[model samples]
Every structure is written in structure tokens, then in C-alpha cells.
Target chain A: MDATVTLKDVAARAGVSVGTASRVLSGHSATSPAARERVRAAATELGYRVNARAQALRSARSHAVGLLVSDVRNPFFADIAHGAEQTALASSYVTLLANANEDTAQQDTYLDVFLTQRVDGIIIAPQGEGRGNLRALEEARVPLVFVDRVVDGFDVPSVTADNAQGVELAVAHLAEQGHTRIGYIGGPPSVSTGRARLSAFLEAVARHHLDDDPALITAGDFRRASGGTAAAKLLAHHRPPTALLAADSLMAVGALAEVRQRGLRIGEDLALVAFDDIEWFGELDPPLTVVAHDARALGATAMRLLLDVIDGGTAESVVLPMRLIPRRSSAARPHTAASHPSV
Target chain B: MDATVTLKDVAARAGVSVGTASRVLSGHSATSPAARERVRAAATELGYRVNARAQALRSARSHAVGLLVSDVRNPFFADIAHGAEQTALASSYVTLLANANEDTAQQDTYLDVFLTQRVDGIIIAPQGEGRGNLRALEEARVPLVFVDRVVDGFDVPSVTADNAQGVELAVAHLAEQGHTRIGYIGGPPSVSTGRARLSAFLEAVARHHLDDDPALITAGDFRRASGGTAAAKLLAHHRPPTALLAADSLMAVGALAEVRQRGLRIGEDLALVAFDDIEWFGELDPPLTVVAHDARALGATAMRLLLDVIDGGTAESVVLPMRLIPRRSSAARPHTAASHPSV
Candidate 1:
């Protein structure tokens, strides 16, 4: 039997027109019972399976969605991809996952590929403000959903974490621990999470009456190397912070390396807190303090939103709440017990 | 301008046939220079973009490859995916990654989907021994390459780590450290890595004149929770081993948790070693000793082999070498120094 048997072959064998055969094979109610029966028999006899590309060309529905994450190696994004892919699979939709590698140019390249692929929809953890293929996707009127981060000027439904609340929780805990000078390592300002979290950190710092020194703030590309660079800059400041907070898990790992290289001990000499909570964070020697949010839920929710949009239904944006989990990394300051009686 | 402009529309505007327009647009050398120029002008004027699905149908090539990993959330597989996707992109091909979630059924489902999507080739970290869609894919003559694991009786080219060498290295290291009774936490026997590593462990132990107690070996399903379960079983043995070795990173993590829960200090009371070296392994309190293999290189190599097969070239199987990195976790046995006087 020929493996590449087409619909035309089935139609010919069924003694029916290609249109009637297609309708019957696609389970369209418009087909007569007799025509459907003949087409079914012919298809079964010929061992003909529907060609997904041809079907997609005809119906304009590929039954596939593109999921573009900032970085695939990042555990947070990996969890998200797992969640989204599983959710999409449950709906009989395949997810084509792409990694932007935290580069805006790479993100744009993937967005263009996704557009060309003509996926039913797209869910993206965007890298930059609205530019390049991001604008093209919007102009093409593709059903789009943002996960974790969003582009500016795009009115797209998104699933994001509560950056302000997470920052507040971490800052408040540090304040309670009598850490008056805390360094901040954040993501690049081009990204929504970076902007939102940095602003939230500033707000939290002001609310806690802590040192609001501009020199205490630094930014990375939300990657490990950048985190180490940011940490180095903050630690070298003339009035260095006693504590440090990284906006993401990779950066936190990088910051930890820098702190260790400087002969400073986490949870003892300097306090540290990270935004995302990875599985192994708790297994670290002194463990780690983290602002926790569900990365899997973020991906799942973004997929759900994309599915809804694909079905021609509008979806509302979702902002998930965050909480702080204090571990040994942010243990209370021993020296502060004398100066700050509250400690 | 209409977004769905067809080649026929461009052909009509160019005063040429649809076939001429298609050949010109697809960069076929058979097209006349005049027709090509006219079709290009018409296509540009009408803002006509070739639909990827339609092109795939016409060419029988999707210019996409499906990569099905055993587990997406596993850092090892995630790194592999990143490498494969990046390599595929460099060749102007997109990689559609799917997570098998460590289940055979899920692997079959994704394989079938990849077939339906008419991908040019596929790379998989297979779960079971030559069953389900694996057979179907083989019969269909799809360009296939195996990464990390290969099924029995399959002639498929694979890029796999030298499991025997890795296991031998770990076993010898433990033996040299004065651990005669080493408990092994291995992957399920059904998997290639699991079977190969276990057999290698047995052979190494017998060669070194160490204890070959069957009770010292336990198997997990190459997952975290399974590792913990296996560890629990090993630790509960009446004559428990002084040191433990996990076959994979996730299992190692699980074993670590189990040891911690029992208040057994790693490196001091119980030595530990893992097969794969994750990035943060060195950052652990006592750090982790691991048999390290380049997961990214494995993925990249698999993809290159697949592309070779797709281009009608026979490719050779690649066996990547592994090395052991000794850390505090697998430090020398303290009491053995006095008793054996070999330190």
C-alpha cells in the first residue's frame, strides 16, 4: 500500500467528488450518510491518513501553537514549557516551543518563524518592548498571549506574577531582619518583568525607609553571568549593601558565586533573596531565600488564554500572587541586635 | 493590502501562469528570467508571502524537525533541547520540541503527531524498547536519530554517552576512596542507560574485589521521587553501604533529600555521587561528585546526524565519553584511613 495515499485517491475509490470525500473525512455534517459511509470505507481500505499540512491549508487551522520562552535552560522557563505543553496536549493541540535565549534579536527571529508557520496562536515570554516581529505578529492579527513578560504598547492578554507584592514581601522581610542597606540586582529595563520588579523594589525600599541609594541598584539580562556582574558592581560600591536581592533564579546563582568568590558567606556575612524558587535552591548548603510564584501555572494559564483566543473568545489578563519563603540565605543579622532593638 | 494573497493572484497580475509564479517565487532555476522578474514584482506589489503549510504540502518537506525528550523539566534534557534547537536554527530548520514526560505512551503520541506534521526528521530520547510509534516511524522510513538512549534491535543511529565507562569511573573512584560496600541508585532496567550502568557497576565491583551484594542495588524510573524511594530502600538495609551513587542528576537530588531527612550527613557519614553534572551541583553545601557528560553536545550531535540522514547520507553512531569530577560529597572515608592504613 502506498503510504502517501491522498484524499483524491480515497475520493476516486469511493466514486465521489473530492469535495464530498473531504467533507465526509473531516466529519462535516453537510455530507450525506451514503457518501460518508463510502468515503470511510475507502479511506480505511487505502490506509489513508489525513495530511496535516493539506488539512491546515484547507481549514486555516494547524492545531498547533508556538510557545516562545526567554530561555529554555532556565528551570523557571523549563517548568513553564512543561506546563504549557501538557495543557495544550490535553486539548489535542501540539505546542512548538522556541527559545529566545534572552536576546531580543533571537526573540524576533522566533516570532517571525512562528508567524510563517501559521500556528493557531502564540504564547510568548517576550524579551523586549514592542519592536520587530512583535509588531508584525500584532499586525497579522494572530491570537497572542504573553507569559511572564509582555511587550509595551501591545494590548495582549497575559499571565504574569505580582511583581510589586513579591518585591514588597522580600523587602519587608529584609527590613524586619534589620537590613537597612540592601542591594538590588534586576533584569534589563526593556523587559516588562525587569521594569515592574525594579519599580516595585524602589517602592518597597521607600516604604521600608531603607537606604535608597541609586548605587545599590544594578541590572542584568536575567542570566547567570549578568547576575555575577551586577553583584560585583553592587559589592564594589563605596557604601556597599549588607544584603542583596536578585530578580530571578539564574542571577541569584550568579550572585551567590560572586559572593562566595569575594570570601563572603551567604546567610552570615551578607543576606540574599531571589525572585524565582527553583527545586535545588533549598538543597544548597545554606539554602536560599526566594520570592515564590508558580512558573508552571503561568505557562498553563498562558496556554489556556491562547486557546480561548484561538476559539475566537476574548481572555482576561491574569496576575498571579507571589509570596516570600525565608531560608538561611536571609537569616537575621546578629550585629543588628545591638543597634536595632527590634532585631 | 490583503494578508492571504495567493500565487494565483500574483500570476494573474504578472500576466503569467500560476506554475511560472510558483517556480519563480520558490527560486527554481527552471524559471525564465522575464517570468521571474514579473512574478517577483507582482508578488512584492501584492505583499504576497508563501504559506508555509502550502509550501510543505507542495515540497513534502516541512523544514522542521521534531525533538522528543524523555523529560522537559529535567535540566539535562533542557540543555539538550537548547543545543539541538540552536543547531537546527543555524541550518535554517526549526526544531519542534516535545516532552515525553518519561512515559512510553506520551513518546508514541508525540511521534505520531510529528509524523502527521510531516517533519523532515526526528530526534528522540526514547523510553521503551522498540514498541509503539517507534516501529511505525521505522516502517515509514522517517529520518530518525536517538539521543541519550537507544532501543534494542533498532538500527537507528544514536548519540549516547558511554554509560559503562561512566559507571566504571564512579565505581573505581568509590573503591579507591575505601568504599567496598557502595549502594547504587540506578534507573529502571528497561532503559538502556539503566541496564548498561548497572551491569558496569557489578563488573567494576567484582573486578575491584568489592562486595557484590544484590541488596546494595536499587532502581528508580530515572526521576527524583524514584531516586528517593530507591535511597530509602538502600538505607534501610541491615548492612547499609557507606557510600551511595545515583545514576542521574534528578535521582541524585532525590537521594540527597532522603539522606537529609534521615539526618545522615553527606561526605561525612555517607558519601554520594551522581551521574550527570548539573550547573548548580558544585554550589551545593559539600558540592556533588558527578560523572559528567556534555548533554548539549549530545543534542547537537544527534541533530547533526539527523540532518545528515535527511540529506540522504548514512551517519555513524556517536558514543560520547564521560568524566568524573570528585567533590566533597565523595570525599575519602574518614574511619577507613585508620583501619585500612591506605590514606
Candidate 2:
């Protein structure tokens, strides 16, 4: 029972040249129906699996896509990866993922490897502020798309959430609840998403006619520990905020722990809203109010855009929509009712 | 500016033959100190960024390692990938990770891609059923090490958690808590880790002189939804188990949600313990008692073993240690007077 089947056997059974069989099996549309059907039947009969490695070397297309993320442990990225996987699977392509851990050098290394492997395209959630090697990838005519984050001046294809609008929704939600003194716990200001969301928060505060409290804003690196640190700093302010807006879910989790640690009731004592509705958010004790970006949608859209780019479509960018999921965390502000004249 | 630099330029600047420069740059110790010094100086002066891809193609060894995970979204796999990357970095070997998504076909696709990319070695967590096209990969003489799970008959180098021991720890801990009848919810019996853990759970019950209650055992596909289903069945039993042991973290999360949804108090009404100490486990309300397998350690050890295999070591398996992390979830049992004191 040697069971090792090759494309040659498939070609022989199909009565077509090996090249035609290869094309049919690779899902290339150029193959005629008669030839494709023959190849398909032959493949089934022989139990012949396409030799993807040989095909990659011959065609210089790996039939694999590269997915680069800032952090793999974050459920946000995980959701994106899952979405990308589903899309890739549908198209008969596999995804190779790399977690750059926000390291610029690692990103470069992954890009080089992807190039060497000749992947069809790359979808990356870049660690903001590095475009040197990314530009090199573009120069090499590699199909690359940015996901979740965008580069400063690169005219590359991308699919990202409406971070500013999402932040605006969170801010408006808080304002409607009478949260005047609101705190902003954002990711590192170096990242584009963080900067955009923070700016939106300030603009929303002004638009809602609320006083800006500079002391209540603290920055984090989008990790739980950073969230805890930011929350602690904001809470210790001379005039602490009545509500908090976390830039991401991990930060929100950290903030929740911080609030609990201090014996503060989530909805009663302090209101909170966050971004990126990661899985298990709904399962939390007091479900969090969040400006939710569909991570899977972002990944799927980025993959589609990259595939188009790989097929010679004009490069473009996409901004995905966001939704505000209201939960128990944000409620009517307790302090405002006593002071307002409408009461 | 045409920024492409080649080995010839460095050799010319160093006033040495191309062979001498190539050997020196490649870190071949056979080269004399004078030649190496000249090559180093020339490289530094020329700012030569070696085209590692070209070098790899010529020498047939990429200073790269391929890592294949079951799913990138699984925090357990992500941690393992992180560990592998950290270790690969220390050795100056870049790590390329692929998310197989537990699909045999997809896993086969990645194995082919990895082979074509010519990674020096690979660390794979197989999809856990069937021999797959892995036999072809083995025939290619690629250096590979299995992580987390391995095929029953394949004598591949591997590094995995002590699943049996982990289950024993959980069962023993619960048993000591005065819980008699305990339910075991596990993944598909086809998976090595799942079957091993489930068998160990039953064995531990027998060893501890506890009743072998057939109604207390159920299996799922190792999904949260399946865990919820399994939990429902167990809780609905006439004499519900005093404690529950889940095969993995996601299942535990599912069981926890189900228990809470049913208005049963965890750590009191129904004690719960699970495998895989995922990120949110500690942050979970009432926390989670778990048989903690260091996924990071598993990846690092697997990669280390892969490097060894690449360097001519025999294919052997290493079982990493597992421990129990006590949290509030399984602190006490409600039915303290039950005769099955061994939970």
C-alpha cells in the first residue's frame, strides 16, 4: 500500500498533458471544462493530491497568503485570523500567520520570508511608524494589504475599521448618559488607530459641549497591564472621570479588573465603554459597552482586496463599518441629575 | 537608487576571492582569521545586507524554522508560537508560522509550502487524526518535530504536555475537595490529548476508589458550544455530578457560562476545573482552577528539539510537565456529605 500519488498519474488517466492537469487542479480558470472534468475524475480515482510545493516552484505562486498581526494572543487578532482563514479556505488558499509582537524587525523578517516563499499576497496589521521594508515589498511588486492599521504615507491597499467614527459613537453614548467628565484610556499614541480614536474622543467631547479634562487621559500599549496602569492613573487624578473609554478590549478587561479590585461597581459607581468586541465580552459579569469592529470582516475584506491586487486590479483601500454594542457597563450618570436644572 | 548589493561587491572591496568571502560571510569556521577580518570589514563598509533568500537557495539551508499551529485564534497555540519565536530569535533563525485550522487538507497544504520554502526544520501540531500526506513529508527527509499532539504510529520527534498527569492533578485536587461524583467533558475521542485526558480522568476515579458513574462522562468536539451541551446533559441528570473536569479552556469557559446561566453557583453548587491556562482564565469571575500546561514551553521545546533533529539527532518524544493552578472556581463542593469524596 504505497499510497503516494503524483500529478503524472493524474495526467495519464485524464488523457491531458501534465500542465493542463496542474492548471485544473490549481483552480486556474483557463482550463476547458472537458479537461477539468477529466482531471477532477482522474484525481479522485488516483487519490492524487496536488503537489503544492512543486506547483509553487514552477508558477512562482505559493497558493498561500501571509497574515501578519501585532499580537496573536489578542482575541481581536484571533477573530481576524479566523475570518481570513474562512475566506482563504473558500478560495483554496492557505494562510500562514506571523505575530510581529509590534517589532519592526520581525515584520521585516516575515515580509522577506513571505516574498521568498512567493505567497499570493500579504495582509498585515502593522506596528505603526515603519514603512521602509514595507515599501521595499511594494517595489518588489508584492501584493500587500494593511489590516486594522494603516501606514503614514503609503498608498497601499488596506481594509481597516472606522476607528474615529467608532470612538465618536462611544463618546456620544457616554455623553447621552450625562457623563461630562469622561476619561480616555488609549493605546500608544504612535499607532494610527490609537491617535485617530483619541482625537475623535476629544472632538466628540467638544461637539457634545463637555469640558475637556486633560488630566484624565492616559495612554497604553494595548495590553491588559497597560490598561490597568492607565486606569489607575486616571482614577488617582484630582478630579477623576465619571466614565472611561478604553481603546481596545484587552485594556477594557484590565480596567474591569482595576474597578473590581477597588471595590467599585461597574455600572453603578463608574461607567465604561471599549473598542473591539472580542469573543467572551458578552460572557463578562457586567457585559461591557463597546464600539465593536468586526475583526473577521476586516481580515476578509483585506484578503479580498489583496487577491484583487494580485490579479492586477487597481490598488484601493477600504474602511469597514463599526457598531456600538450597548451593554450594562454604561448607564445614566448618577451625579448629573442632581445638578442639572431640567430635573 | 538601485539598492541591490551582492556578495561579489563585498569580495571585490575586501580584495579577496568570491569563494573566500562567501565562506567567511557564511560563518564557515574553516576560513582563516585574516580572510574573515577582511570580509567583515568589507561587509560593514559596503553596508551589505546579505540576500538571505539567495544564500539559502544556493546552500540549501534557510536560517528559518517553520511553525504549524492548529489554530492561530487559540490562545494556547498563540502562546506556543510566541515561545517558538522567542527561541528561534535567540538562535538567529527566523520563525514562519502557519495556521492549519485543524484541517487535514490544510495541514497538508502547509507542509508542502514549508517544504518548498525550504525551512531548515519545522515544528507542527498535527490535526490529530489520520496519517495524512505527512508520509510524503517524512519521505522528503525534512527535519520536523511534533508539538502538542502527534500521530500514534509516527515516530517523529515531538514535544507535548503531560496530558495524563495534568488530568490526574485535576481529578486529585477535586477529589480532595470532598466531591464524590464528578463529570468529565472532553473533546473528540479521536484527538490524542482529549482521549488521553479523558482516560486519565476515568482511571483517576477508579484509582481513588470513587464510583464509576456512567452518567457523569460525556464527550464533545472540544468546542465551547459542545461544552455547553455536555454541561446541560450532566446538570440535567437525576444525580448531577458534584464537580466537572473540562478537557480545554474554551470548553471550561462554555461550561462556566452554562452553569451561571442555569443559576448554579460555581465553586459551590458545581465545582469546575479545566485544561490550558488561557489568558482570560484568571480574569474570569470566581477565576478558574485549571490543569495548566505551559503552551509557550511546549513550542519552545518543540523547536529546540527540531533544531536538534536538523543537526542529526534521532527522532524522539519529550513530554513537558503540567501543573495545577488553583483559582476560586473549584474551591469547594456543595454536596460535602457525598460518599464519593474523591471528586
Candidate 3:
């Protein structure tokens, strides 16, 4: 047992041939169920991990990478994924993607899966504080890069947008349009984007000398339904802001619906601006004004960084610039529309 | 050479220990590159697969499933993925997703990857003819299920929408609204949904005695850019149709942009209907009327079928129904909006 326990040792202990033990370890279907159970038990008792790690020792390359997106349903993230995937394809590596659903637990599960899958590298739009699998990846020296968002303590190479500048542009535009109060719908404080954008909103509002109402800010989990809930909360305040700025596009959609349901109109009764300029934003009734960041570029850059890391090259973190696209949703308007038609 | 070749034979041929041979076969990265190359060459020369098939014999369950979506960026497929992932998670299984990007070659690549990963089952929105990995999946007796789209000539269990009926509803609605010709933006004919929907449109037009102008039909590769191309082609016709029916949400978005670019207002200058009623589709300028299919249900159903197949149960193919949701996009109106407002 002390002399490097192998499949032979496990097979001997299980009273099965080495071939049977090997079949059981390889997960092939031709072996008897009884043999499977016995060999597995024997392997477990002998602490035999060679089955999973055997081939990993021979070649450092898996020709596969792990991509963890915060939410696949978010058009911004989806675009980023497309860009990353295309770039990876050009490099002859396939990406295995996992949706974190913006939950730390799901993120941990997928990172664990990626390690077990023995991928060569990883790119992630990280969620929550660095812990669990995120920390494990760093410790294991897995090639890693962050995209869109970064964890607080992780010094991983990343491709993130300048949230402060983007927020300032949106607020300055609204302030020029004579809006003294703006409701802010933000993502949870757990994520880096959420903290950065929210902080920027606060700074921008103060610089513009807008109303410092405590009720003006609400947070959502960055999912569609939570966005709706946050929007509703912001609107229910006794003294609601004359304009709304959602930190992400999904929340902006919810805010739009909430405003329309109240028989108010965007670009008229209230001004609106959102982060993340999705393509369909232009097709909305009022053409949502946005703090536009190239999501696809962020994804593509992250993949490049990961590849560099995999090749034993140094990877530098990148912060992409963001801009505001002015549209009808933030245009100054006369009091015209109150009742809205169904979209 | 006459007897069965084993990992031992390959190890002997490669001049490595049995443990080293096993490590190389298991894809472990800890072994030396030279050892890996030798072992691989030896295994190939001896036709040694016993090591690869060994663990597969244990339970034949990797607790992983493959989901090959047509396009992950499409909101419909994203919703489906969410549903399938949630369902799989509830059953303590993980799903490995791949994007075909509406390409047959990409589909083949992912299907082959799934086999090597030893996934317990696979759910695919298949593209092109039933060859390559599709045939390989059947021959290998891997649990397989199709969703959203299906390939011809394969008797695989599937969860597909009634595409013909969905198309029929769209055409009939347009006919009842007094449209003589309805422009159709459809997917490529290589996919089942594309063929079935197009056929249904043609049959419906004939039944209604509407003009059979061939210019009314145009096909896209099921991406946003192609949708724009098809719509532009349709609108450029000498006698353009009053109504438009796009095959999917992304295409509909492209068509909407094209229509607006031509200074046409939806529900006024041109009636538009589409398939796949995505969540935000209702939030478009004129809420799109759609032959709505439950995309999430399709995904969840496909996962259930795959699970059934994995459990050795006979999986019956499921065909879900589609319905029409009337919105302003398809409202009958005069051709009034020649100069559309920038939205």
C-alpha cells in the first residue's frame, strides 16, 4: 500500500483483474455493475487518483478552455461570449462555457468542473469576492483572466470597462437637460461592476449638485425580474426622481416597463439612460440612450489574455473606454405623452 | 498480435511503466511530453482502446450532458439553455453547452467533443444532414435528443415546435388582415424549421389565393445581419409586400431596423409578425405579434427526454404547440408613415 498504490493494487484488493479495474476507472459500460461497485470501493480505499490525473501529467495542453459568464441571458454577456468563442475558434481551441447566473455557488461549481475537465486556461466575468474555486484556480496556477467584472482581491489579468467615465457621461447629459433628481438602479454590491458604477453614480450626482435623496438608489441582482422589482421600489418612493439611470440594460428594460405601466413616457414625462448598449436598444420605442461599452471587445481581449497566460507570457489587465450614445430616451421634451401603447 | 491488445502491451512497446501508459491515456498533464508521445504512438499502433473504455464500463455515467444550441446569442436559445440547465441541475447533472453558430461543421465538432468527454447524453438543435457525429452518436448508442430543430432521416427522440402550424398561423393572420402578399424572412433550408415553415407559408398563401410572387420569400442564415439582407431584398422588390413575417426574434430585429431605415413605421406603414416571442420582443417599438413557441419548455423537455434515454427508458418524441400573440406590429393600418421618427 505504501509503494505507490496503483490500479494493480486496487484491482488485487478488489479481487478483480486489472482490466476490470481499469474499465471501472475509465467509466466504460461493458463491465459488470458488481465489478464497477467493487473496483470503485477498492480505488477509494487505496486513495487511487491516478485514474483522473493520469493523462494530465503527460501533456500540459487540453486544447480546451473554460469560459464563465455572469449570465448567458444578458445580451451583453452573450455578445461577449460570441466574440470570445470566435477568437478561441481561430486559435483552434474550443471553449466550454458555464453560466454563473450571478451566483457565487454556481460559479464555484463550474470552476470545479473546469478543473476536473483539465482545461488549459479560463476566462471569467467573476462574481462575488474571491473565494472557493476562484481562489483554488489561482493556487493551482491555472491560466485565468477576468472579463467585464473583477473580484475585489484577485490580481488576475482582466478586461473591464471604465464604469466611472461612462456613468459621468450619462449623468452630465441628464444634468444638462435640467433633471435635478435621478433614480439609480444598480447591481448588487457583491460584484465589482456594481460597486464601481454605483460609486460613480454617487460621485456624478454630487458633482452635478442633484438632489441627494437617500431613496433615489436601489439595487437589483442583475437578473431581469430583480431589475423589475428594483424599478418598482424606486418608483414607489413618495418623492421619486424625475429621471432614471439603470446600471445595466436589463434593469433599464424593467424601468421602461415600470414607467410605461404608470402611464408615463420615457423621453417625455421622465428621462432615462442605461449602461450596456445592446443592439436592440435602438429599436425600442424611444431609442434608449446608453453608456456604451464594447462587450464583444471585452470578451475577445479576455480570451487573448488567457491565451498569453497559457503560453507562459505575461498578461496585463486592460480597462476599455466607454461612451454615451444620446437618443430620444434622454432627450429634453415637453410634457406630451402620459398613456403608452403596449410594446 | 493475434491476442487482445492491452495497455500493458502499449506500455511495453513504449518502454514505459504501466502507470505511465495509464497516465498518458487518461489525459493527465503531469507526465513528460516525450512519454505522452511514445505512449500515444504505441497505443495507436497496437489499436489499444481498453484503457479509454475501462472507466466507461463502471456506470456509463459521466453526470454530464451536452447541449448544442444553434446560436447562444439568440435570446430564444439562451432561454432554452437556462431551462435545460436548471432542469439538469435539479437532477444533480451538469450540462456542457456548445454553439453550432448555425453551421453544420461546428455541430459536428461539438458532437465529437461530447463523445470524447463521455457525457451521459446529448441534446442538439441539429443542423444539416444526419451524418458525421449525428450518425456516430447513434452508432455508439449514446443517449441523444433533438430540440427546436431536427435533421432529416434520423429517428432520434426530439422536442420540436410545430413549425408548420406556427407558420400557418402567421400567414393566416396576415391573410385575414387583407394582405395580398406577405414578405417572409426565413432561415436556411438546410434546417428542419426552415424547410417546414417555408413550406407552410407557401401552402397558406395558395389556400388564401394570395399573390404567389416569388419575391415575397427570402432566406437568411438565421443571424441578425442576414435578416437585414433578406428584408432589404424583400423591400427592394418592384411590388413590395404590405406585411412581413420574420422567422425568429433576432431576424425580426434586423427586419425592424431595415423597415425603419426605409422610413416605414411598424403597424402603420408595414405590418410585421415574427416567430419566437422573446421576453423583450413585447418591448419593441410596436410590440411584435408572434407565432409564439415556448422555447424554455423545448429545452426542459429535451433535457427530460435525454435523461429518460440515459436511464434506459424509451424516449417518445415531443412536438409542442405554438400560438399567436397579437400586438401592434401586425395591426391593419393605412400606409401613412413615410418619415419615421428616430427611435
Report the Cα lDDT for residue A116, model 2.
72
Ranking by lDDT: 1, 3, 2
Model 3 residue B243 distance off true place after TM-score fit, in angstroms: 0.6
Highest-scoring model, lDDT = 1
Model 2, C-alpha of B152: deviation from truth (Å): 1.3
Model 2's chain A TM-score stands at 0.82
What lDDT does model 3 reach? 0.83
- For model 1, what is the alpha-carbon lDDT of residue A166? 95
Q: What DockQ does every candidate get?
A: 0.50, 0.43, 0.54
Candidate 3 B-chain TM-score: 0.81
Which ranges in model 2 have alpha carbons more than 4 Å from their true place?
A: A1-58, A331-343, B1-58, B314-316, B336-343
lDDT at residue B149 of model 3 (Cα atoms): 86
Q: Give residue A47's error in model 2 in angstroms.
A: 36
Model-by-model lDDT, in order?
Answer: 0.86, 0.80, 0.83
Candidate 3 ranges with C-alpha deviation above 4 Å: A1-60, A333-343, B1-60, B334-343
- Classified by CAPRI criteria, candidate 2 counts as acceptable
Ranking 1 against 2 by lDDT, winner: 1
